[model samples]
Target: MKNSQLYKGSLNTIILKLLEEKGRMYGYEITQKVKEITNGELAITEGALYPALHKLEAEGFLEAEVEKVDNRLRKYYKLTENGQLETANRLSELEEFIRNMQTLVHPKWSY
Candidate 1:
């Protein structure tokens, strides 16, 4: 699936999980990682990714550090203490949402 519609609800959780797994990542790296992980089923565009990153940073859920990588000054994002907690909370919420969706979609199937 192109997964365009699914981005809104899951993007934050996805970003947090990636950061949780891989310490720090830059914008392009984050987009690549998401594509790699999902086998290209989901693609986060630069336009979408940067704004989300900025929003998270503004919310104090993410912290960005600037460093010179190769010939470019790349901004790497990592989670703060609040962000770590928020990640866990967001993941839980996502799991609950999945379960709820499964229930609604498949009424006969119970997990």
Candidate 2:
């Protein structure tokens, strides 16, 4: 498993990107999907996940819906209109950062 610091900075971006791709997702579903996609190399703890989610919701970048499923409430999150735009912007920023990091750290590779 990677260190928390390595994943910490990207948590919000990761969540935004996932929501952008998946439309809407519940918390556990998000955690599982991330683990699946990363082949279990990374995991999102409730400690980290909930705060990021709550912050995004508070910042108007996400909206939530609550539904009763199997005698419990499940809160699902989706991007707002502002969030859709922010997704585009954040994605671009992330991509650009990746490119820059590659240039610095993997300069021998040919893209």
Candidate 3:
């Protein structure tokens, strides 16, 4: 689904979940991971990603650390305690959303 507009609210949830699974990741890594998982259907742009990461950090949902890789300083993000809690909530919400969508799209199909 190219150009399948992602809801802005779910952005944080997606980032938090990814960080929870992968431990720590840099900006590029985060974008790549999402793209990989979605099979190139959903692409997270740097513009959207950086602001979300910063917002999460500001909200105490994440922590950042800097590391040197190949003579470049890369900032890595990891979930905080609050982030863990947020991840659980977000995942549940995402699941519910998917279930509701399935019900709407396949009203006569029983699974």
TM-score of each candidate?
0.93, 0.92, 0.88
How accurate locally, in lDDT, is each candidate?
0.89, 0.92, 0.89
Per-residue lDDT of candidate 1, residues 24-98 (tens digit):
899999999988988998888888888889999999999999999899899999999999999999999998999
Off by over 4 Å in 2: 108-111
Give residue 20's lDDT in candidate 2 (0 to 100): 94
> Clashing residue pairs in candidate 2, if any?
none
lDDT of 2 by residue, 19-74 (tens): 99999999999999999999988899888899999999999999999999999999
Candidate 1, superposed: residue stretches over 4 Å from native: 109-111
Indicate which candidate wins on lDDT.
2
lDDT score of model 1? 0.89
| Residue 110 Cα positional deviation in candidate 1, in Å, after optimal superposition | 12
Among all windows of ten consecutive residues in candidate 1, which has the lowest summed lDDT? 1-10
Q: Please write out the lDDT profile of model 3 over residues 6-95, one tens digit for every residue.
A: 556688888999899999989999888888988998888889999999999999999999999999999999999989998998899999
Which whole-number lDDT from 0 to 100 does residue 76 have in model 3?
97
